[model samples]
Target: MEVRMLPEPHTVESYRRSVLGLVTALPAETVGLAEGLGRTTAEAVTAAFAVPRFDNAAMDGYAVRAADLEGASPESPAVLVRLEPSRAGSPQPRPLRTGEARPVMTGAPLPPGADLVVPVERTTSGRFDDGATVALWRDAKPHIRNRGEDIAEGAPIVRRGVVLGPRDLGLLAATGHTVVRVHRAPRVALVVTGDELFSDAGPRAGIPDSNSVYLRAAVTALGGDVVSVQLVRDDEDALRRVLDSAARKADLIVSTGGVGPGTHDLAGRLAAASPDGTLARVAMRPGRPQAHGRWRGTPWLALPGTPAAAFVSFEAFVRPVLARLAGALTGGEPASETVSVGWPGRAGAVRFVPLAVEADADAIAVHPLGSPDHASHSLSAMFRAPLIAMVGAETANVETGQLVPVFEPA
Candidate 1:
């Protein structure tokens, strides 16, 4: 096997922009409101009915006319007759008559002809009872929650590109929406390459294929689904076959391993052969060798075989692409915090060092979890790390107590 030549390294920003530019969101799909949580809205969802649906009481109190309680106070309370009680989800009570008050539980529909709610505590009827007449100590204004107050009918409750959450699901369901139209999660094919990789509990000769575990979790956490995960030998024929099938079935193809310059690195050879492929060395530590190409109109990305390198590369490149394909707004940079840290740095390449973050009352301190080179290959350390500090390429050395931007993993 001949050594594959790597194209000159591209700046991380430029490379990310290039790769992400080629990918787009998948087709939209309608799913039940329960299943729509964490999915991006394909279009604006308008409320069919008001959020509350009907006017209801905002508190547990007596639903009465504000005029009936006028001039009522603790020293001189207004005596009013009590009507049938109303509780949440129960039938609406009868309208309040002159000199009458109706006991209402929290969230009960406010009856017509009633505009105020005198809290039970403010009246001589300390709590609900068969009291003939209760004394209203203080004049209470209407505590009724009006219809369309939370959400107006036909108003947009959720906008496009917004990811649904727990509260979002409730709002949609409350607004009489049984189903929601959301951007379908992009189907990703994991074309992991390694002849010695095994899925068994333990590998006799080769290392266990562990990248798939984290990669799969990462994909699902980012709102994408892994359509298939295929492990192939370090041979051109086997890799090409998997890539071909994955390209046809998946929206994105991600391959790990077989991108190096070794004799068995056929992934690089195949990627280099593609018409639009660019096998470039990225200007970064740990994850430098990478390949990007198009196979049968499907975009393919290849990362180095090492677990640490693959994960770091995934965070640096694949994350934003997945976000874009999931219809998430991918404009701004990653959310980062400035923390005090001192670690090794590379002068010519950007460094991503995982840090165990600790926050004081007003200051955040970050410490390197393991070797800054990530060569230790400690999976536990990676899991424990909450932040990855991005030291710029020009940064030669990170001094103690210096503030550095760090990113938390998803």
Candidate 2:
């Protein structure tokens, strides 16, 4: 038997870049505004019409010409004939003739020839409807919301590559967009390999499978569609069959377990056999071993079997790649935060520590939830963490109040 040499380990940043390079943006698909939340815009969406489509009242008041209210005061008020009331969504009322006032509700279209609105609070009759002769206490400034004041017609409403949120969808809807064009959600297939996970002998015999649950929820939260989730034993043939099937059905295949350099590590063995595959260690704690490459023209990322490692691996590598494939602008970098407590770091490897973040008006401080060693199997500790602090390899120890790069889990 010939001996095989392992490839040199890659820096955490470099490995992430390599993984991202494996896939491209998916094609665009049209979706209704109601279904556009969390989807990435395929192209810049321009406003079909101006916001506040017509000149309208900004508040509930009487619409009248500014000249008509001139010299009006509380002691000696100007009395005008009240015309028909204008409520929002109602047809436009007759124009405001000189010395004529119209009761206009908030958002109601301003009648032509009206230049200002006197709030009801300023008039003797504070109510919306009371007497035909309305007395204005003082001259009021124009309170009309002009058409296109909030958003211009044909102007960009949402830029391309932006992930649509509730506010974004609302903006689009307000701008006369019933439907939006967004990138197709990437379809992912998960393959979990481990005989222990499916043992019928109960918890005493083997541990319950948490990777599948975590991965499924994470993928969906990030706008990925999980097409299939398969659980297979440690058998090589079984794993291969599942993988081949997954590749045919999914845009990306994510496999957990069987990625280490062990005899039962079928995922690593198969990756080594592929022409474009790479099986290398990254200079990061918890999730250092990574196998990524294309299989059957579809991208495949093999993560470690340890639950914590798998979780961290997905966050550091898969999340960004999935976002990119969905046509979202790449999040440039993990934000920096100050660690509230000190934590141990690996000598030559970057440490990823699960942390619970506390935010106050002044600043955000992070506290570690896992062990100082950043063990790969500490899934329970990581469950309580909302953030992952990236400690540099050069730093053997992280001092309290030290600033470190942090990633928010999806």
- 1-410 per-residue lDDT for model 2 (tens digits): 11132578889889888888888999999999888888999999899989889999988889988888778788878899988888999898878899999999999999999988888887886777667789885443678899999899999878999999999998998888899999999999998888878624455768778889899999999999999999899897888789889999999999888777777777866765665677888988888888887778889998988888998899888998899999988755789888889976657888878888778999776788868574576777777688778888888989998988988888
The candidate that wins on lDDT is 2
Scanning candidate 1 in windows of ten residues, the lowest lDDT window is 331-340
- lDDT, candidates in the order shown: 0.81, 0.85
List candidate 2 stretches off by more than 4 Å: 1-5, 129-132, 199-204, 358-365
- Cα deviation of 301, candidate 1, in Å: 0.9
Which model scores highest in TM-score? 2
